[model samples]
Target: MQTKLTRFSFIAAACLILAGCGFALRGDSSIDAKLQPIYVASDRESQELSSSLKRQFAINDVAVSKRRKEAKLIVIVKLLDEEKRSVALDREARDAEYALFESASIELQSPDGTNLRGPHTLQQRRLIVNDPDNPVGEETESTIVRAEMREQLSIRLARQVEFWSHQLQDQP
Candidate 1:
């Protein structure tokens, strides 16, 4: 009984310390009420990022507007650019590993077109093994890596937006 009580007391103290330091879990972050009815605008090539952002906003209970006219805030995600480069070579000078780079620009603004946060660029990279003998296998691996990179980029973008929203809320 003494051991159980001590353990409980330790946990309670830890929770209080964490809360006092303003540390919050991911799901505990909330959006500002004034930033509701957010409009997400993106080119056709950025559909994946736009969709991912929309899903994240929904999860955070932020209102997403399908039309720009109905929005108080606008988030623009530009089309993604992808590049492939050889990063490593075998003794024979052939490609042994390749790096895939993907990047996109994001901007946050209000209805009046005033910038709120930034026109920031977010980038992601992944290294893939090169299998010259099996072209099909190499292509398949590249596709999978690109998809994974996209998901990671989306998560990072969501986190940045969340931080910026909190900053906005903290303003005087």
Candidate 2:
């Protein structure tokens, strides 16, 4: 009886050691293994964000205008601000350039049939301003700021999605 007890104890210790080392199967990622498709409305920034997400995750993209898209992960982005403040002046004391801060707000909802609405976020920020002296007009400067915001927002949303995807893999 003592010999059998000792053998069981050794086996249990070895199993614990293996578990502590994070030895688990790989195929199982998140409780919902089913590929939850992602879809987003076109708000310039959303378009960029959707493209970025598509590249990162194996998700199907659907048009927001389509009724079925409502069932999947839907995201909408609102261009919050695109302001520029005079940071410095030229030799003539003219408003040489402005320190621009670009901010965007996003709404993401993973519906009931698939995944519930996530943390209600997906935001991005960046500073962008055109060369005020490049002879570019105010319109051109505005365009540059919008473009920069789109690019930066795309990067931030992609990173957040990747992090969430990894979290899914670890949990039950």
Candidate 3:
């Protein structure tokens, strides 16, 4: 009975400590009201990133406007590029490892086209060790990694918008 009580006490204390530090789960990060009704405009080649952004915003309970004119804030994704290259070679000169790089050019603007935030470039990279014997598995792993990278990028973009929204709120 004493051991069980001690375990309960420890768990309660840990929870209190985490709360004191203001730690929150990733999904609990809330979007500011100023960024609601946002429009994400992306080039045809960047549809995946656009979809990721819209999903993130929806998760945060923010409505992503389908039309640019209906939104108070607009996120423009000018370009998204993906590149892969061999980083390591096997003994027989075959590719043993690959470096995957993805980058996007993004800008924030108002409905009137006034630049709110810069034309910034965000980049993400991953290194994958190849498996010559299991080529199909390697391809599937690469695809999953790319999807995760896109999700991470979407989170980053959402945080940027939240920061900008707070700054705007503080302005007179």
Candidate 4:
């Protein structure tokens, strides 16, 4: 009985310490209420990003509007460039590894054309290994890597937007 009580006490103390230190488990990030009903404007090249952003916003309890006129905040995402460069070469000079680079510029604003947060550029890269004998496999693997990179980029962009929204709201 004494041992169980001591263990319980230790666990309770650890929980208090963690809470006091502001340690929180990973979960959906909080977004500012004022930034809800957002409009995401993207060019054809950034359609995937826009879709991902909308999904993320929904997950975070923020409303996304299909119509710009109905939104209080607007987020513009533009695909700047995409490049695939060979990073490694085989003994016979064939490409062994490649790096995929994707870059985009993002802007946060009000519906009335007020710049709220950014014209920030975000870049992401992913490495792919080429199977010299299997061209089809290499192509498929590269596509998968690019998709994964895009997903990661979207998560990062969403976090940045959320952070900025909180910061702007806190300002007097």
Per-residue alpha-carbon lDDT of candidate 3 for residues 74-122, written as tens digits (9 for 90 to 100)? 9897546798889999997877999888888778898999998878888
Q: Which stretches of model 3 miss by more than 4 angstroms? A: 1-5, 8-24, 27-29
Give a tens-digit lDDT track for model 2, residues 1-172.
9999999999999999999999975331121334245554446644554554444344223223234344355555455565667766777776665666655555555554344335434444443443556656755766666566666565565455444645655668
Question: Residue 124 deviation, candidate 1, in Å?
Answer: 0.6
The whole-model lDDT of each prediction reads: 0.84, 0.53, 0.84, 0.86
RMSD of each: 5.7, 12.5, 4.2, 5.1
Model 3 C-alpha lDDT versus the unseen true structure: 0.84
* Model 4 CA deviation exceeding 4 Å by range: 1-26
TM-score of each: 0.78, 0.51, 0.83, 0.83
Candidate 1 C-alpha error for residue 170, in Å: 1.7
Error of 3 at 114 (Å): 0.8
Lowest lDDT sum, 10 consecutive residues, model 3, at 27-36
Model 4: lDDT of residue 98: 88
Report clash pairs, candidate 3.
Answer: none
Give Cα distance to truth, residue 154, candidate 4, Å.
Answer: 0.7
Count backbone overlaps in model 3: 0
Candidate 1 whole-model C-alpha lDDT, 0 to 1: 0.84
Distance from true position, residue 25, model 3, in Å?
Answer: 1.8
Query: Which residue window of length 10 is worst by lDDT in model 1?
Result: 24-33
